[model samples]
Target: MKFAIFGVGGTGGVIGGYLANAGNDVTFLARGAHLKAMQEKGLTIHTNHRGDIHIEPCKAVSADDYHETPDVLFICVKYYSLEAAIELTRRIAGPDTLVIPILNVFGTGAVMQEKLPDKTVLDGCIYVFAKRSGPGVIEQPQEILRVFYGFRPGQDSRLAEKAAELEKIMRAADIHAHFTDDIQRDALTKFSFVSPMGAACLYFGVTSEAFQENKEVRETFIGLVKEVEALGHAMGVTFDRDLVATDLRLMDAFAPGLTTSMQRDVAAGGPSEFSGLVSRIVTLGKKYHVPTPLYKKIDDWCKAHGLA
Candidate 1:
C-alpha cells in the first residue's frame, strides 16, 4: 500500500523505514538535518529486536512538496505539532484516504475526525521508545515494536476491516500489530501507567528503579499512580485497583534505572508532553472533584526545575 508518514522523527522513522524495506511505497515528510540526511544517505534504524536495518535512497519530501495522495497516512508528529500536521494531511488526503494518528493524547481521534470528516480516522497506540541518535538514524529501545489500533466510536465497518488488513500487512512487514476493541481505554490505560512514572521520575531526576530504591521515593511513586488513577476513573476510564499494584511490581522489576522517555526529554530540555500527561491529570482531577495531591506535588516540582 502507498503510505505517507508525517513527522518522521524517531518513531516515524523506524516504522516507515521498516515498511519501506518491506517494499511498500513509503513517503516520509520531514525537514532540517534529519531530512537532509535521509535524502543524502538514507534512514538507518538500529534496534535490539531486528538488529541494524537501513533504508537508503528512501522517498521523502517536505509536507508542501508531496504530490501523491496516499492510501494511508500515518500522523506521527508530537502532540504540539498536530495542528500543522493536520493541515499537511489535507494537502495529500483523498476521499478514500485513512488517517492514523499515533499519539498519547486521549481526544486526538475526535480532533482528527472533526478535521477530516470524509476520511477514515483511527486511533493508534505504539509501544516502543526511539530517539534520533543522528540525522536519519534511529536508536530503537526494543527489538520489536508493537502497534494497536481501532476505529473511533460511531465509525463504520470499513475502517475496522481496514485496520484488520493493516495488522496483517504489518505482521508481514515483521512489525507486530493488533486490533483493539476499545482504543480510548487503551490510550488511557497507557497514560495511567506512563504519565505517573514520567512525573515521578522527572520530579526526582532519577529512573523508576532508582526512584523506587528509596523507600520514601517508592511510596511517592505509587502515590502518583494512585492520584492519576483516581482522576482517570473520575473521567469515566475505569482501571482496576490491581493494575496500580501491578505498576509497582513492574517498577520493582524494571528497577530504578528505568526511566520514561518523558523524563529523558525533560532532562535534555526538549519539548515534552507534560501538559497532555500530568497537567491534564491534575486539571481533570479538579474538574471531577478528585484529589490529586501527588500530581500537584510533582507538577510543582517539574515547574520549579524548569522542566514544565
Candidate 2:
C-alpha cells in the first residue's frame, strides 16, 4: 500500500521507517528541521528490537508539498495539531483514502470522522515508548510496539477489507497490528493507561519512578484509572479486565525516570495535551454522569498553575 505518514514524530517515524525499510511505498509529511534532515540525510530509527534502521532516499515533504493521494494516511500529530491535520486531509485525501489516527488521546478518529464525514477514519491506538531524539532521528526506548485499529460500532464497513489488508501489511513490517472487532473498548483500554499516567505525572511533577515508589502518587494514579473505568462503563464499554490492576501492572513495568509527552511538553513550557488527556476526562465525566474527582482535581490544578 502507498502510505502517507502525517506528523513524523516518534510514533509516525517508527511506523513509516519500518514500512519503508520493508520496501513498502511510504511518504512522510513533516516540516522544519525534521523535514530538511529527512530530505537531505534520510530518516533513521534507533531501536533495540531491530538494531537500527536507516531509510535513505526517503520521500519526505511537508503537507503543503504533498500532492499524491495515498492508500492509507496515518495521522500521528499531537492532539493540539489535529485541526491542521484535518485541514490537510480535507485538501489531499481522496474519497478512497483510509485515515487512521494513532494518537494517545482516545476517540480521536471518531472526532476526525465527524469533521470529515466522507472519509473512512478508523480509530486506532499504539503502545510504544518512542520519541524523536533529533532531527530525522527517532528513538524507541523499548521494544513494545503494538497497534490496534478498527471501525467503530454501527459505522460503515465498506472499507473493512482494506483495513484488514493494511493490518497484514503492518504485521509484515513487524508491527503487532490488530484489526480489532471492538475499537471503542480497545481504544479506551489503551486510554485507561495513558490518561491516568499523564494526569498523575503532570499533577505531581514527577517521573515514572514516583508512581512505583511513592504511596501517594501510586494511589493517585490508581484513582485516576478507576475514574476512567467508571466513565468507560457508563459509556457502554464492556472492558474484559480490571482497568486499575492492568494499568498498575503496566505502570510498574515502565522504565525508571520515564516521563510522558505531556509532562515533557509542560516542563518545556509549551502547549501540551492537557486538554485532551486530562481535561477531556473531566468533560466526559460530566457528559456521562460519572464521578471523576481525581481527574477534576488534577484539571483544577492545571488551571490554577496556568498549564491548561
Local distance difference test scores for all models: 0.77, 0.92
* Consecutive 10-residue window with the lowest summed lDDT within model 1: 250-259
Residue 246 displacement (Å), model 2: 1.8
Find the candidate with the highest lDDT and give its number: 2
254, model 2: CA deviation in Å? 1.6
lDDT (Cα, tens digit) per residue for candidate 2, span 1-308: 89999989889999999899999999999999999999999999998776989999999998999999999999999999999989988988887888999999999998999999988888999988889989999998788889999999888989889999999999999999999999999999999999999999888999899999999999999888889989999999999999988888888888888889998888889889899999999999999999998999999988998988
**Highest TM-score, which number?**
2
Pairing residues by index, what is the TM-score of model 1? 0.89
lDDT of 1 by residue, 18-103 (tens): 89989889999999998988999999988766778888788988888898989889998878788887787777788767788887
Assess every candidate by TM-score: 0.89, 0.98
Model 1, C-alpha of 101: deviation from truth (Å): 1.2
